[model samples]
Target chain A: MTSPRRVTPEPFVWLMFSAGGVVAALILPVLLVLFGVAIPLGWVEAPDHAHLLAVLRHPLTRLALFGVCALALVHAAHRLRFTVEHTFRLGRYDPAIATVTYGAAAAGAAAAAYLLLTAFG
Target chain B: MISPLEARYYRRRMPLLWWAHRRSYAIFVLRELSSAFVALFIVELLLLVRATARGPAAYESFLDTMAHPAMIVLNLIALAFVLLHAITFANLTPRAMIVRLRGRRVPSRVVLAGVYAGWLLVTAFLAWLLVAA
Candidate 1:
């Protein structure tokens, strides 16, 4: 008797993407507005270097930043993977495309974790 | 029976600039491109963390680099794109999530409001933390 093929573990990947999307939506705009526009345009005084450094030095802040960075990378990887595949009609190379995108995200998250840990530890 | 000639249909190839032809498509493409900016910001933060690891002088130097005019312009552009990304993503949340209460489907506007409310609370908390510090 022929056996049915196992379903791929795609939902977990999608869950990561969804979580990242929520996190990015909640936080990124605020960060960008503050650091990118308000400070640069003089609408608000930029946080002094010492103060900003102190915040980053905080353990909780480091963890939060690391979480955002890692998850956002996964989110971007998933989006870019689909965007490239659809735009270029590369559906035939799905496995290679997924590997490259997710691999890059994993590497980025690893780098972020290493930097966050060593920099503050 | 249908003739082969009658069954055949022409397929118009999607143009390179197809996204440009419609405002919605352009916005979508820009939204996807915004992820690159998000990645850049992550790299920038990593560098910041690295600088902090090196101590005050390195961190100050990093701030100096960030204060440069070119970096400011790039950051402003990034801010615009990222804001667009966030808004579009937030608007899509209601569709992606199906909330239910007491066996009835929750309204989409309610879901959207909840998402934005959460965003507002988080932003307020961050702002308060920054100001208080």
Candidate 2:
């Protein structure tokens, strides 16, 4: 018989989290306009389709869109956190850096998302 | 009398997630929270404009008090943060788009440059049309 092995169940918490994050990123901007900005600006007097499209199409949209997608990327890597944690037992150096990268990348995405959505949307 | 029906299945969210997982979620939220300022600036300015339209004194106060040096400086700083919030996000959009070309991954910087270039060209053309007319 082969040597007995120790095994730990990989937790899937981050996997679920990133998935939710991706969904939230897309819906948040549209909701923000409808619920937050639009009412204050007076929905009835809001500009017609052409202006709306222009504003939404502005350079900012690309920027804010980064938010929605960034969450997805981090979410992807985060899903493997447990696997990575167990695979080689990496800590302090690469793991710390990975965490930072995830945070920074997400933030960068968010900034782009907000810029694009608000400026263009 | 009508009886209240049993609720359908409800999803459960954890009170607090484990550290690694929580950190990512927090970052997601914090970044979203920071960008709120851009909307605040735009909406506040719109409100100020609307208020100014009401009377001379209102407009004067908007120009004088609200536009005071300290507030202007604050706004300038806010503007920088807002721009930071914007550009960072703009550069990230391509990744989300999932578009690919020529069997190689396209660079986000290229996407950003193309977007910026298009805007500048459009703005220039519009100015020309307006000026000529």
- RMSD per model, one decimal: 3.2, 17.4
Q: For model 1, give the RMSD to the true fold.
A: 3.2
Local distance difference test values of all predictions, in order:
0.81, 0.45
Report the C-alpha lDDT of model 1 over B25-48, residue by residue, as the tens digit.
877888888887877777776887
lDDT of 2 at B3: 38
A1-121 in candidate 1: lDDT tens per residue?
9799888768888898888877877887777777665765667776666677678888899899889988999998888888877766676798999999889889999998898788666
Q: What are the interface RMSDs of all the models?
A: 2.0, 13.6
* Best TM-score among the predictions, by candidate number: 1
TM-score of each prediction? 0.86, 0.35
> How much is the lDDT of residue A25 in candidate 1?
77
State the TM-score for model 2: 0.35
How far residue B85's Cα lies from its native spot in candidate 1, in Å, is: 1.4
For model 1, the stretches where C-alpha displacement exceeds 4 angstroms are A1-5, B1-12
